[model samples]
Target: MHIAAQAYGRTSKTGLPTRELEATLLSQSAARLAAARDRRADDFALVVEALEENRKLWSLLVRASSAPESELPDALKQNVAKLGAFIFQKTIDLIENAEPEGFTALAEINRNIAAGLRGIPADA
Candidate 1:
């Protein structure tokens, strides 16, 4: 079976579907933010790192969603763009202030998006 699977060009064991990868990445990012918030007084640098990573991911998402060939609906693209903008602004604010409170909004955004990608039903 393993040989047949390999011959059939099965994806590498470490490879994940696009949606799963996004959700996993988002989860990891949220966890980083939580950790940063928890350790702000002892090691604030971790907060900066977490925020920076989140910023990069959101930037990529914005660009991908904005692509002309993207299959996402216009409404979804608009929403993603708006969220990306907010993420950008919030990240900047966090960088300047380095407050643990700022992580809440960012983490929530990531968590919700990840849940959506995972096909988890949203709250009514």
Candidate 2:
């Protein structure tokens, strides 16, 4: 199933609000990336798979935020687009160079965004 559709289905089944579902997905992506980063030395393929998943999640976000029917604010949509571009570039860079440190920014961004969606401070 498509990631967005799966998320929607999960929300409907669990009675979670859209924002909460989004936050949960983001957190899951972040955790996957972080775990892959930590285990990169043991298994490089994990990193690649995690990066692909993160990219897919970001792609969905970018498309949704950019859609004309989206309720996201213009500034937020622009920010998501910019972040998506960076994430795509970073994913390519990591795939090419295989730097564990590079995963930090990607995971951090997801975590911060998830926290925002949950109405919590990133640090907290």
Candidate 3:
């Protein structure tokens, strides 16, 4: 998928308070993945399936968060937060399991993701 190309345009069309929050989380995840790519773009490209799964999760978060009004709420916001955290943690676990020696990539990705998430506007 055109994940790298598409992620840069991420934003919320839905006025739902959680939409921007979701976009923020997804953008941060994408940035983390990008950091991994920077460290070993060729290596990650070899694990296309893992990368594809990451893209799928990101896409799901975007769509779910951006859904129209009347279908959104604070509970969904909490779920979004939970989901983002879960994804990041799971990614780290995967890295640890599959390439323990490559922990730097995992650590860097998590750090970048956290930083990006922190940058999101709270007024959403």
| TM-score for candidate 2, residues paired by index | 0.91
Worst 10 residues of 3 by lDDT: 4-13
Cα-lDDT of candidate 2: 0.88
For each candidate, what is the lDDT?
Answer: 0.80, 0.88, 0.51
Best model number under lDDT: 2
Model 1, residue 61: what's the lDDT? 77
Q: Give candidate 1 regions above 4 Å deviation.
A: 1-15
| TM-scores, all models, native as reference | 0.83, 0.91, 0.34
Better of 1 and 2 by TM-score: 2
Error of 2 at 16 (Å): 1.5
Of models 2 and 3, which has the larger lDDT?
A: 2
> How big is the positional error of residue 36 in model 2, measured in Å on the Cα after superposition?
1.0
Our tally of clashes for model 2 stands at 0
Q: By lDDT, rank the candidates, best first.
A: 2, 1, 3
Cα misplacement distance, residue 46 of candidate 1 (Å): 0.5
Off by over 4 Å in 3: 1-45, 52-71, 99-124
In model 2, the runs with Cα more than 4 Å from the true position are 2-5
